[model samples]
Target: MDQAVIPFDWARMLLGEEPPTFLLEILLRTIVIYIYTFGLIRWIGGRSISQLSMVEFLLVIALGSAVGDSLFYPDVPLLHAMLVITVIVLINKGLDYLILWSDKAQTAINGIPNWIVRSGRLNPDQTSDRGIGKAEVLALLRIEGISNLGEVEHAFLEANGDLSVFRAREPIAGMPIVPPHEICPLPHVEPSLREGEPSPKLCCFDCGMLQSRAETACLHCKGEVWTEAKMPDSRLA
Candidate 1:
């Protein structure tokens, strides 16, 4: 017999070798569900493998139940039903690969994670931009068993939809003493702003660091503000 098509009797027997179309359609449906489920979840923002907020967690359960309901309906024809599931799965996989292979597709499907914390401090604009709160921040920290603010060195709300925590052995230095280079200013602001705004309180110039404010002449290179601007950018180790 040609393998591309099944004989009517063969189809009937398979639909229910014992009862309904033999389990072949169910098996095909299962395979489609598995491949698409795994791949689609990957593209939908990494919720499958990571800790999720209450809303995110609920979405997974609802999606799984909806798919399961469609798979189990008895009135649907066996082969046709399986093909429908297969089509849906293929669409999912295709989208997943598109997101993986193209940067633009990724940006379109899921926006980036904003920085909730920078320089060991809360970033209000960034947090508000993403609609995240300090309560969520506390929860993320508690998962890492860090209850105190001082213990956390740096934390990031990562792009793959995860809260990445960085705890250092030494607590970050206090602003009163460390040079300005040691500080990381918040996003959306430039360095070298005067004090009307809440810029970093400590001035590197005051600490004998090469800056224009504390001294008219930079102590290290005797360079003025323009010369200081040309200095190499600082690197964090």
Candidate 2:
């Protein structure tokens, strides 16, 4: 095994230096802190650092504070710091391994995403588990001008440190929403036209077949709903 020998510096202070050993000590401490921080970050995870949960969030803050120690203490030897960092990194890796190997352990540490909204209802159990209440959810919804859960087609607490939602319908407008199920397309039907002038007047969406002389039906097929009006072809309107 290779070993690093860091000797104590005690004479620089006596050579008219402003406690030169203090500077070395600070450097040493910085090295140690850097190692630990790097390892912990790597092991616990740094790729998705911004997505840490509650406890992990706290650790990240603490990690920042630990890194700040370098600003005040510099005498810490770099090798010792590296050693500590390596150990921390190892520990992080060990924890991750445990999480990966055990399903139950993974759930205990980092929970899986849960369905907070289902069947147009906010699940109370799921809300509580995420440490969030209905009020918060509603508040978020309100921010998006959503008044009722019915407006939501799908809502879930994402493990990526966010709450995402999708709504069912087109929202009475050109809305991009999360659809629960694929739309069952209506069978293709030809458009109806007014009977006259060689060909019938093409169905225009702007003014549906509903003219002053309108009956309650598609003029040609007599189908009550002018389905074609709502179809993509309606863009010609």
Candidate 3:
């Protein structure tokens, strides 16, 4: 080993002894592969890593492994790797075609979008099916700048696993349109007997009349029952 070190093979050092191809050949091959992979990815709907779907992720892994091995390994044939990549892209395109033409195929490949919130109410049933909890929903809401379910008109668990939130165009004054499960009961206030007390404490549900008490009937409209006026929270304001 010492004797061999004394006489350095400059040519071998500069250009690999058992080179897969010439230096020029390797350079061209690498360039070709890079360009081809980029075009393929673009054709197959390229997305940022954070936005990648399962199929896109798998495609990235497969392309990276194959291209990297062929670029440096003397034993790996470039043409063979290229062929494999080409076949993979072809299969991906085929799947895309199927997805476009067949509803079942699209649902199977991409999954259906789940409605997490509808009409300002959380969809408990939808979340349960997808293994999502209320905490996760709340976190997602915050990500979309929503402080509470009351502000959301509709929210969806997209097919790619992202939360898409839609806000109400015209929010109700005090009543949040949220689901029945999330409605909070208010404290009942007794009707004031004194004439000097606060006037018309609640509004009749059936009629527009305001009354100081939760009367059996509205005085003006002769309607039954009333609901307390709800004010918007500080966060909403």
Q: Which is the leading candidate under TM-score?
A: 3
Per-model lDDT: 0.46, 0.46, 0.57
Give the TM-score of each candidate. 0.45, 0.43, 0.51
lDDT of 2 by residue, 184-224 (tens): 32232334355652332232121123222334454433545
lDDT of 3: 0.57
* Clash tally for model 3: 3
Question: Which has the greatest lDDT?
Answer: 3
In model 1, the Cα lDDT at residue 164 comes to: 78
User: Residue 216: error of model 1 in Å?
Assistant: 31
**Ranking by lDDT, best first?**
3, 1, 2
> Superposing all C-alpha atoms, what RMSD in Å does each candidate have to the true structure?
13.9, 16.3, 13.0
User: Which consecutive 10 residues in model 3 have the weakest lDDT in total?
Assistant: 172-181
Question: In model 1, what lDDT does residue 10 have?
Answer: 43
Which lDDT tens digits does candidate 1 get at residues 133-200? 55566567667665344345677776445787877566442211112233532222133455664332
lDDT of 1 at 45: 47
Task: Looking at model 1, report the run of 10 residues with the lowest lDDT sum.
Answer: 228-237
